[model samples]
Target: MNYRTILITALSCALVACQQTPTKPHAPNNLVTQAPALGAPVAVYTTAKNTEQRLSQGTTLTFAKSVQPSEGEISVFVNPHKSFQTFIGVGGAFTDASAEVFAKLPQDKQQELLTAYYDKEQGIGYSLARTTIHSSDFGSHSFTYIEEGDKELKTFSIDHDREFRLPLIKQAIDAAGGELLVYASPWSPPAFMKSNNNMLKGGKLLPEYFESWAMYYTKFIKAYEAEGIPIWGITIQNEPMAVQRWESNIYTAEEERDFLKNYLGPIMEREGLGDKNIVVWDHNRDLISQRANTIFEDPEAAKYAWGIGFHWYETWAGGTTMHDNLYNVAQSFPDKKLLFTEGTNERFSRDKYQHWPNAERYGHSMINDFNAGTVGWTDWNILLDENGGPNHVQNFCFSPIHADTRTGELIYTPSYYYIGHFSKFIAPGAKRISTTVSRSHLLATSFQNDDGKTATVVMNQSDDDIAYNFIVEDKEVELTIPARAMQTLVY
Candidate 1:
């Protein structure tokens, strides 16, 4: 598939072809660019410097015969032969609020946004998606598929989703060539099933309603599958430990473990949905290890869980980051997968939408998360209006693409370009390869795609342009990455 290049400056930027390099000869002390070796050992670079170029197709990078002796230079070593985690691909969420805004756009503009996000040749090529099981903070209002106090769930119907959300998802799936892997998550169960008798505040799932709630999942999954959208997995709850004004439910690790071990797990198996992934602890990475331990220590609960889900909010709140906690979880439960289920910039402002730092945050987190053993990454929203959201609870946040609901305009943020630097080139099932860099300013991760191609993404976060040597086996490509820029060297 042909991938479209993106520019950090504006959404209207069009695709540009790769430029051929000038063949000027160089002296021994200067950087020497040798042609790529025959067959397998070769590399080319495409970069987005956040100025004139965004995902600009650049010249092929040939490995030099020897490393040049220079000051303030760094070296990045890549080992495609030594690979780690298999990537599940990156994508965003589909929320009712997003669909509402999307439906307001003109038909042509709606297709443009979809192409910008899911078209493998012309967009970022998102392969996975998350959807709210009922309603989230991003929804226009609180809603549930089942009627109040319907303990038997005879009234359970996904007709609510058919209105806007599912249709938007179907279009995205079509654009992605029917390769979208969708997972469902609930912010809260129906108000009648919770202790507080309401879904807005922190409430506990009533013990009496446990079985019905488990069955509720089965019905919803079956309904969606009938609509041609397979449910890839389901999270126990979204941010189970937090109490928000928006819809939320509190499930201590113990509560979550018990529900899965006794209720959801057995019900799923009995209904022939056991193969569907059941993820635990859909919360922050700060307490991820503790939660994982609590749930996985029980052999019964562990058997029910397919993986662990986490978010990036903890680090943003001045708490600990992924390194310690993520390492702990990976080391403790090496067999289970780790997925970044939800994350996005907060306190939305239109001015910050184009902000490069926000985009850099995504790159920084993604590289570190991959190094820490995350298999997949999912952003929060696929699209929001110019106001950041039509969020019922006023929990506004920025998305990669923001639609001008009044004028039918689509605005692509810097995050879109930054995310494309990885998602556009790296295909699903790619394995994270070993990549070690000598300097602190440069952060990077390498992946060998399923197609037998290698992609190495390096970001220069420092203010000054720094020359670097990218070495893979016997070959070393010498190049200078501009300041505050990122490049993907794919071969």
Candidate 2:
């Protein structure tokens, strides 16, 4: 079916579901239904078994008196009053590769992409964004803002980004209703500032260049702001513990802590850029807790850190994702925030554009991460070419949306819809409410918006379609989730 037909059918289903009146009880054995004073109608949207059903609106469920769930029956319970972390937002990195690819697309396609990601009415509302400090593996080449030996940074300029990156970022901010919380991260400092004098293959930041390196962040923030792109924060380093063929830098937890407290933090304050958030440990979950302890346990360093940032790459070794570590850090330092800074399905191939597992990966991680007290989440690259790159190090990876640069065609992956299942309904400033599920096959999270609308996202990964009771306080609604599908119920 065409997009218009699908949208209309979905909306029709929602309208019918919302307007239907309840008849006398034909209550099932598991639920003894009684009339409850209903509040707002619950509108359900699903991206389910059918590819056409992406973010499609389904029936609006009616509230009935809460019933005790039977022994084997599945149920999803949401408590709107009991809330946790205030959501910052959800989005992807606007990397050089994304920007360069975006520049190659047709004008109309470019507009379509911008609207698809940033326009709340026409697209998934992405209020948060990330960009690199210099060059990353995702970029075409290694780069720095200043001349190689310019420690004084007087020769610093963002002219390199003027051609593609900066313009795309500015347009994205405008598309996001003139407000987007953007954070910057560096994969490595300039080669001259590193011990190995190379931007690739993990090297340490030379101790002598500590002061100049700190000043680099301030200069980047100012330069971007000068172009009318306000940076919300900066992570000390990206994947600080990893050694890769691409740009990388290593920082022992203590070294990172000392650098922050002694150099970066004080320098920012001295330069009057202290208000910008400073995020540390932009690495994986395996070392997150240790990194948090090393930095947070030190009062001076802790004062500089706005939060801890982590990635999901540690799971690449073929083990369970260490989601528990996030909770451990959150509980250990309640004052410090947690952010899922980067995650994306690697090993890209044109054939896997419609890959469902990729989408499920996002759904699974996002639900658990938010439940673990993460305030925000960011995906890796916002857009990539059909070949999955323009990647300099030949490390091509998947993006939720890929443009076939040759054909000027856009391929929307299931991951895009999966991400939309949360980002679209859960607004910024929303508070995550308490949500729990009775079945192991299902995963869920809920957030209550400032407007009193609650978005409860449910994911069914099991093979069989499951019917469950969606319970909210004293009321409940019967619902069925398709196998390997995700739904967002908004009320």
Candidate 3:
């Protein structure tokens, strides 16, 4: 029985591809609380007898529904109903993986993993990625193309980043058949280009460097090209609104418009970097109004722009029903695309490590964005050390895959598997489609591959088992969702 065909309901003439019957009841809500240590109990349900508990989590994780555990086959049909496309990938995490971390892994394991990373045709796929033009909080330290006090015409080069980060990233991209999509952003301009003369202090980009900084970015792009890496997209600044002690700079709406309208856009056109696109407002989602205001207000700045970008840090309810963290900023103007540029699970909470095991959270973030019509999705950092990062400020969070600094032991977190559900099956060209579930706890989105085969991925991140009946083309089937587990039900 194909899981996807039973549940998907095609709007037009369609065929059932999975075993989804409407008669299947929603899974019962189950809770895993006291009586056992935090992670001591492990129970699986699909294989349980009728009198047994069907859904459980504690020790090893199991994904099973109430249905009998036969060797039943499920084939997912790719019916991409939505008409949109963009790149998807993780950012800052692996690009800046320390030499210390790389040296720890065995040469064979390292090569194997790198091959797995780039050989997208093989499965583990990353079509798009975000990188700091220089060092952001996720990097070794803060630096930029031009040094402080070098306000002259003679010295402007990206020699700092040229040393290792660029080369390391290029190696991975080269192995992937060179299909990686790169979007570069600056956490903060070099200290000399900022109001503050120190990289550690919060400062705004000085107006004086606006034009020269655009030139600086061109050089960075040219330097990477020299290394055989083509940058697909770029943002004016990382978080133009946030001014952190780490590598950060603030850009008010006025400044952003002036920079893009008067400086960056014109310079890119002059240098003939027209093929690579530029996106605006690479900041939080809550500022949709500000983004709409900025882009809508300026015809030229908006004209030269490719799309609008947002991060998932701040929650916006207006866009919630549309998609989990989606905002209504782009509703008025639907022509431009909305892409989630950066988000991470590490929020400096007291229980940072506990956050790592909750693959549901990462799953929630991805589905929320995808449901909201985000063209693509990208996470903050792919790989960070045990404490979340090697951040200079010591403010850290966990990564999808963590490498023990001392042992080199790799612990694949929930984020990794959560990403696999979408990335592994939904390649770069796949388009999202409409999907309806029995209840709200089970969030879902359907996609159609290039060959028109439909892939539907659903997540039951709630603590209880929620049975699902996916109807496509008027045919339905039963799918029992295990509690606190995510299932990619495809036909």
Candidate 4:
């Protein structure tokens, strides 16, 4: 069934008070004489199946004595003390299309959109952001910062960004309470620097221009900083393995490693941009292991790399998402980090704004990725036009939120609430804690924020409403999750 129909059905059930099987109280686990205090009561915020609730605050839950799980009864157990990776943050990209659309919206709508995404209380509280270095397929056209054939590296400027992109980014930083970790990635280097002399198709960077290309990154970083936008990090290339119709560059595993070790790494240091994170293999999960191994195995190359960045498009060929690959990389390189750089539901249709699966796609990935050891997650475009984009090559895709520039209205997709389930409650510097679920239908992940508050996210994708016990340490809270819903229990 279509999403709207499903949502209507779900809402009807909610209004009528859908019945759930009750769980009989079980004997307390006598393993502990006293269970640790679970702090304040947990505030439940949920986005439920077929309901208008989008991150809507629900009933508060107080922890009681722990109960033993009965067979077939679903339960989520969270261990906040046992933590894994530190969470960087969760956010979306500020692509040219997003910026351009923002520029077209009415003044109040612009503020509304910015507030909807960045305000800690009113919005989703995004703490991370990504943007293209110059131009990507999401831009209106391909362009470079410098004039063509200026190999002397004297003509660098970012005047193009001052018009629309920079303003939006600056406002976003302000809306985010004056702090947002922003990063950039290049789809392709300038045409003159590539073998094909065009940035549209996949082409290798000519060996002669390696140093110049390395210098380009430093220039971009400095220019943006001068514009009052601090660049937190940058990926060497976006989707280095793919050959697409839009801007793309090819770099085999070995080639990317060499460029970092011998060129990009040292240049950034010499230019005093060493503090900026250098991420390698901003590609997909399918070959993330190969790319991470090749670059991270080399001490020289690995030294400069802050982490490995990846995308979610590897599943486009109808293959299962290679989530285990992320675990393998994390297990292999405990010192390095993993960041989900970019991902969005592709092939956007205006009618599918309420599409439930798009949101499920996000919940599924975020849970698995965090469980598998990813520090942060980034969605591709924060906002796109009604057409799904003003994309240069018409490579349209779905964003969590889209603006109908023609109508001056904003559309918040289910994906937006799906992402908010995590980003809103889990602050940066939060650490992933251990969470065990008793059923496969219910997926869960938990994080303890720096402020000592723990947020546990549980997603129910099954068709049947499920009653589950939320357990932490020796405390338990009985909860019921509607079919195809997600909840973030925060205390």
For TM-score, the strongest prediction is 2
Candidate 1 C-alpha lDDT tens digits along 1-491: 11233432222222211212211111111222222343434444444444655676666666555555355668888765556777787899999989999989999989988888887767778888999888998978899998898999999898888889989999999998877889999899999899999999889899999999999889889999999999999998999999999999999989999999999999999999999999999899888988999999999999989889999889767764565688678778877888899989999998886788878888888888888778888999989999989899899999988998888878878788788877777777766777889898999998766556677899888988888888776567778788888888876
lDDT of 3 by residue, 214-328 (tens): 8877877877788777887688887787767777778888788888889998989899897777888888877756765776568988877877778766743444323422435
Query: Candidate 3's C-alpha lDDT?
Result: 0.58
Q: Is candidate 2 or candidate 4 better by TM-score?
A: 2
Task: Mark the 10 consecutive residues where model 2 has the least summed lDDT.
Answer: 14-23
Q: Specify the highest-lDDT model's number.
A: 2
Candidate 3 colliding pairs, count:
38
TM-score of each: 0.91, 0.93, 0.78, 0.93
Comparing 1 with 4 on TM-score, the higher-scoring candidate is: 4
Q: How big is the RMSD of model 2? A: 6.8
Q: List the residue pairs that clash in candidate 1.
A: 2-121, 6-54
After the best TM-score superposition of candidate 2, give how far the Cα of residue 366 lies from its true spot, in angstroms.
Answer: 0.1
Candidate ranking under lDDT, highest first, comes to: 2, 4, 1, 3
Q: Which stretches of candidate 1 lie over 4 Å from their true place?
A: 1-50, 66-72
lDDT of 2 by residue, 1-491 (tens): 44423433444221000111111111111222222246647889888765578889876678878889996899999876566777888999999999999999999989888978887766777888999998999978889999999999999999999999999999999988888889999999999999889999999999889999999999999999999999999999999889999999999999999999999999999999989999999889999999999999999999999999999888888898899999899878888889999999999998988888999999999999998888889999999998899899899999999999989988888898899887878877767777899988999999766666778899999978999999988888898988899999887
lDDT of 2 at 438: 95
